[model samples]
Target: MPGLSRRGERMPPSPIRKLVPLAEDAKRRGVRVHHVNIGQPDIESPEEFLEALRDPGTRIVPYGHSAGLWEYRDGLVEYYARFGIRVASDEIVVTTGGSEAIIFAFLALADPGDEVIVPEPFYTNYNGFAVEAGVTLVPVTCRIEDGFRLPPLSALETRITSRTRAILICNPNNPTGYVYSREELEALRDLVVERDLFLLSDEVYREFVFDGAAAHSVLHLEGIGDRGVLLDSISKRYSVCGARLGCLVTRNRDLLSAALRLGQARLCAPTLEQKAARRALDASPEYLEQVLDEYRARRDAVFEELAGIEGVLAVKPKGAFYTVVRLPVEDAEAFARWLLTDFQVEGETVMIAPAAGFYATPGLGRDEVRIAFVRKVPEMRRAMRILKLGLQAYRGAPARAGDRAGP
Candidate 1:
């Protein structure tokens, strides 16, 4: 057989789920796994979403408009308006998911071999998207000691080369849960404007900000009018991961045209899900209020528990439901695997994402793991307890002779 394509070979596996086989084996051997690896919410989706799916109101499922269902886009316009992001339905190209939107943005904004600057320890799937789009992602490192804030504008500016096409950011960032403040955003606005590059902002976790902090949308930035592209989704917002509904919104008609062509190439997003997304707009505001309250409690539980774990370095996440924790282990991935393969406390073990995969630059997150506080507060506390115990046991294990020996 001819060798598998290089692109297929180069694709990075999802670190969030790479340990599934071991977890499955653990389960087969009668161990309970407390999954804090992925960000799948345990909360119930809104009732209106289920109702819309149950009664799709169409006799036959047909291909939607390449841009999206008109009514659905109409609903999205109002939804964006609620965030003070004024966008017309025509400027939006609904995608299969935020993943698709990112890929499409990369396709529309840059050519193969062209570069886009992104902070290190960004969303891991961006690596796959960059691979698929054939674009190069340049990393500007953000330190966890600084609460994962955007680095100095001078540092970001230093990375810009002639081939640099855009600066991509995830507000309420994944893996770190650091919400970018408005001043930081303004500095980005100034940088992108000065460099004449696109500002691709992924604001999927806008509703999950904690500590009374506000998430500033790129649309709200004064100088970023035409240069801004907003990639958003209902998956995390409404707990509809399987629905796969998301959209790319921008004021740049040229970018929208490019994205729409890509959308046409893919045909269209799922039709029924668009209807469900429309109905999701009708969800009571209290739904998110309650959801936010629960996540806040979970976040507190995670931080409070981590504080008691000796040698674990963690900063309390300001937004989103995740935190990147520096573990005491020499190899976080090996420790993560050992948790599933060898360690357990009273028949229970916790699964976490080794944070190395979340970084584009090599060897940055090797000592860290990303934990999602998706479960309820008590469950999160218990999972942390299991993790703490697991750490102690892993350290004392004879297999970690190298860990005990200093460099």
Candidate 2:
């Protein structure tokens, strides 16, 4: 028998979903599960989006242009204009998803074994993407103590070597929900420009900022104009995850050309989804306003509830819908599985992502889990209560008193 390829074997299972089978088993036994694991928002997709999908005017479902439909690309231009970022349709290469954009960016910018520096507790899928591209992901650990802000530029500089090709970041970062400010981005701008490296910016959660915090796009940076690649998604913005539509934007014609070639290699993104994603542009302000309000309430519910728990260390997330939580258990992954298989508060248990997979460096994030406050406020409150009670029962691993961090 032929053995499986190394890529298949090396690819790590998603920590965000690895415990889903256990969760299913719990559900089979009649345990109601509050899923706070993945960042699938419960907000409804825009009506216009559904309308686009159901249009009887459509005749054939054919492959789209390799660069995506010109109309859809133009729509993306208008979408960016609202944010004061300018890019031409030719500079945008629509991808299958933000996930595809990451892979394309890595392939376009760096060679195999070349390094890209990313902050720790980053989006876990980046590890898979790096492995697929054969690019080395170097970690620059950003402590929860610093609100998950970028470590000092000096510390970041230490990670850059001859093999370093780019620096990647996610604004309104996943897991931590730490929104990078304009000042923080500008500091990154100076460093990347000085080092003459690429800046791959994932701004999928641009509008999900909380507490009146503004998310600064890397495009807003003064320098590194040609080196910036903005990865934008319509998923969270319009609650269109199934749409699987996103685009890679860059002012550099070379990188743009390379990305388009890669797009051709994969054929094209789904034609129908691209059409539906165009409908996202038609979504009015009120839609996001209502969605934001609901998420704000959920965020407050989660923070307030977690704060009351005795030993749990939770940082208040400022953007996105997730926060990295430090649990008292020696192994957060084990505790997460135990919650699904063992503990239940009145027949309800919560599923959370063990944070260790979000880091490339081993032994980090073992004590932490990432919780998504994507449910409604009352559901979130109940989920938090389950977490509080579950922690009390799971060996009662003691944490230091008054160990809270973050603003």
Candidate 3:
């Protein structure tokens, strides 16, 4: 038999889902597992979104334009306008998901072996996408002490080389849930402009910010519109992950054309999803407000419980539904697997994503784990209790006084 190609061998398994067997084993053993691993929200999709699909006025289930339905695209224009991101419908190319939007941006802007700088401990799927594109991911570390704020602009400068093609950022970032301040975004803007690099902003969680924090879009930045590519989705915004409808928006005609060509190759994204997303754009802000309130409650509960844990350190996230906690254990991956495989509290356990997967550098994030606050408040509190109990069960020395609680 022929051996697999080198590229095939290079593909990395999804770190998020790799521990499923352990979870299944735990379940088979009669343990109730509280999942804090992935960011699948428990919120209901808006009624209007479903109603659009149920109306069924059209006779044909034809493929919409490769770029997506004009009405859908136009709705996105208005959707973005609410946040002061001005762009025409023609500038948008709808993709299968924000996952596809990232791939499309990479295909449009990068050649094999080119570099994209992403802050360390970023969204783990980014590693997968970079591997598939054969692009190098240069990571700039952001200290958890600073709530994983983008490291100083100087840190980003050291990673740039001639092959550097883009800078990718997740605003109200994944894994860490750090919402970049306006100053931080401006600092990034200056660097991207100076280096003549593409700026890719993943704003999928734009609506989930808390504590009166507002999200700033790179598209709204003054002169960088030509260099900016905004990756967005209705999945998180509308709690309709199954819809899998996302769009890549840019003011750069050249980039949009290149992305459109890639979209053409795929024919078109899901037609019904596009219609649902179109209706989702018209949903009242109140629907999102209700979801945000629930997430905020969950976040508060998780933060408080983590604070009470003897050896765990976590910051209060300003946005998104994830919290990165520093654990007392030496290797978070080992501890995470042990939690699902061996440890239990009242015949229940919590499954978490090992923080190492979020980092590009080997051996970093070894003592950290990411917990998603997607469950209801009561469940999140229970999960946190189990997490604390698991830590107590681990055979490690206690954390130092001030170190256990961050700055």
Quote model 3's TM-score. Answer: 0.96
TM per prediction: 0.98, 0.96, 0.96
- Kindly list the per-residue Cα lDDT of model 1 for residues 1-407, writing each as its tens digit: 89978789988888888999999999999999999999999989999999999998889999999999999999999998998988899989999999999999999889889999999898999999999988899999989888788888888899999999999999989979999989999888988888899999999999999988999999889879889999999999999999998999999999999999999998999999999999989899999999999999999988899999989889898888899999988789988998999988899999999999999888899889999989999999999999999888887777663355121
Of candidates 3 and 1, the better by lDDT:
1
TM-score of 1: 0.98
Best by lDDT: 1
Clashing pairs in 1: none
Give the TM-score (vs. native) of candidate 2: 0.96
Alpha carbon lDDT at 185, candidate 3 = 84
Query: Model 2: runs farther than 4 Å from truth?
Result: 396-407
Report lDDT per candidate: 0.91, 0.88, 0.88
For model 2, the run of ten residues with the poorest summed lDDT: 398-407
lDDT of 1 at 2: 94
